[model samples]
Target: MSLPEVRLQIAAVTLAEELSFTRAAERLNITQPGLSKQIAELESRIGFAVFVRDQKRVELTEAGHVFVRGCKDALALLEKAVRTGRATQEEIQPLVTIGHSPYVDPVLVSALLGVHLPLYANLRLRVESMFAQDLVHSVLSAEVDMAIIEEPADSPLLTLVPLVTEPLYVLLSTDHSAAHLASVSFEDFGKVGWMMFPKRANPTLYEKVMEAGKRAGAVPVEVHHYVTPHEVIQLISENFGVAIMFKGIAQQLERNDLVARPLTAAGLQVNIRLVLRADQSSRLVNEFGRAFLKRVIPQGQQAEISGQLLLKL
Candidate 1:
């Protein structure tokens, strides 16, 4: 049986990063048994053990290290060939499917789309919206070409580019008793009903909010769960609860009766990023990523933004 080139490279890269079959399979959104079988097939084709496994842990063998390194370079070159082929096909216009979380500001996304669409007139583009949990999964499974996500993924096999970081704010009904406060601290959060994204949808952000609240002297709070910013805003307007929102969304959600109190606490921010599998990198993906970041920084301020080193990681 012939080994598929892409699958072998991916299996090697993912297993190398995780050093555990189960963990790598989870990241790749595949079953552990399935991943193990693929690795076994790859090993058979190469006539070597890629990983030495025990009851508790998995480690790379000497041959595994060499295979992983060679595959990385080989995969990169293969990606280059595909990108070059796509760019040269005059009759073929590649459609780039970009996935985004429900929390991403629609207005900002629309604006960025306007900037990107004109530049890539030859290439088609599609945007998909999903919950954070699903968005990350879609990226790993290649269900979408790329995604704009708030979750900070440290997976070594993925390429994550930080696009923007906006201050978090408290959204409340103007009539709410605490609405009059000039600025809100995490301590003040326990006073109001707290609206949160489902823990699975955005675990990192949820945990961060909870931890900040705990440090700020807040106790057991009335919490509500919602899927979209619209739902959270509607709940706030109805006085059901207040929510932590990134300042970027303020423009998309227009409301005079609802107010946003900036979180004055230092280090309180929402990070937005462009994420994709590192092995799937392409010229178009890089172009779109940089275009989105440039749009965020503004036209004449490109030099200023560059000097400040805004886009990181």
Candidate 2:
């Protein structure tokens, strides 16, 4: 990472303030060698030496005096800025992270943001989208405070909330013969090329889809891996391969060349659940979840939820 200009200025000011290299190093909590290196780097950047040092004593040069004064002024201004920023930043909502695997629900996210953004004084919400395994790892490591994901089996550390249940749909090209059917089964598409994401993306969902195909007593000769929903859609649209995805996502789509049919063979339900680490505590995430539920879930259904923190959106 690049060193900040403020860092160099702070180092210069710290050295100038203390005068003694040992005292300055102590104040900076860095070794004397580290301090010397820092000063050398700063000097290199400025294209001039700032200090003169012998074995016994250290002194600032004429140019060093001028630079030190400017640095001191800049540091004072920076200190004032830090104080002001802290005051303002305190009003900003605590950073609450919410994680998702692939595309969960854009509509719900938008509505939640719109309805409750102004409700809290310090409730800044950050959304992170990643592969299911990575999301689970994030939650496990406390990198993400909460997550809406399909797989709950990987991390036993999480307190889960069963959110929404939707049927899996088989995406088919409009030109495909099975597209004419209202719904299709894995058995029907057994011989067809299968477009699937890696198991790491979502183990539970991937296993369910694959198991469904196996239960149908047939497997595709070719399996194509895709990275995203749009890629899957693009492949299916071009008659490349077919894929299984949550039906709710398909409802929000307006594709004329691709059709999503309910995959009735596996009876697999896409469980998009909200999960947080059981060992961790996050009032921010809980409050955010409450705000989200208030906008989405009805009052009658709200009381049915056992706990505020674990309740799914």
Candidate 3:
């Protein structure tokens, strides 16, 4: 038999993931019969049944297990190759793709570009706004050179560098009754509805916010799930719901409709981290990472100092 076809191998792996021939066909954007024929041909060439057929569910056979694993590895490599090719031909200069979490302070981007422009004048920066989990996946898959995520990733394949830790705050409408308070405990907002991101988009941050509410005996009265931090602020401004976010998010607001109060309660801090693939050794990524660290660390220190001065007053 000739060498196994790449498309056939890919089809086999996709089928293994979906289990149902119809579902697998949808995922691969092919008809069910076409997908079935590809898988059958692959099995024939490899001389082993790839999937065990059943009336209700399709199960992977032993040969299927090994073939699927290999196919996935091949697909990953192909993805990396395509990304690299695009970077080389389309990018006029060295390109660094940086994935950012929703809470990443927008002002930091200017500071980052300012610092790096002097040294790497021709460097191109591409910013991808995504959730922390997706950012981690982008870095791991070589889709992005690096990322600025909410916290250190727990995965062994990524290396995380601590950048800055910012305090979390409760964002209230300026016209709200409790807005004048110096700081509002979670209990103070117990009866208030909250604007929150969806659990799937930001599981870690959502869980952290909920845990704080639980500790204060304050259940989230209502949650307006949104995809971005800006959307959450908009909902708060519209009086739809209040929100809990890091201090820097306050900078994104233009209207006097919102006021940010420190969440003086303990354990409400968020750490911004720089994450990259463990094996990556890109000069452009390293430069951007350094610029990001230099900008955030100083701002964090200044914020700390200002907070202390307020206490002294």
Clashes of each: 0, 2, 0
Candidates by lDDT, descending order: 1, 3, 2
Question: What lDDT would each prediction earn against the true structure?
Answer: 0.71, 0.69, 0.69
Query: Which digits, one per residue and each the tens of the lDDT, describe model 2 over residues 75-161?
Result: 667656644553465356356677786667676657545645454565666778887656765775456777777645533346766
Better of 1 and 2 by TM-score: 1
Candidate 1 lDDT, 1-313, residue by residue in tens: 4554566668778889888887887665455776888888888887788899878998999988998998888777866775566566423675677888777867557755665545567877788988675676667555676788885555655676666777677787778766789777766655667877677666667778788777777754588887766787767767676777766564456478887787776556888877777666556665666676676656665654444222321
Query: Where in model 1 is the C-alpha error above 4 Å?
Result: 1-17, 20-91, 116-120, 279-281, 298-313
Worst 10 residues of 2 by lDDT: 82-91
Poorest 10 consecutive residues by lDDT, candidate 1: 304-313
Steric clash pairs (candidate 2): 93-122, 93-123
- TM-score of each model, in listed order: 0.67, 0.64, 0.67
Identify the runs in model 3 with alpha carbons over 4 angstroms from their true place. 1-61, 68-92, 117-119, 228-239, 298-313
RMSD of 1: 6.2
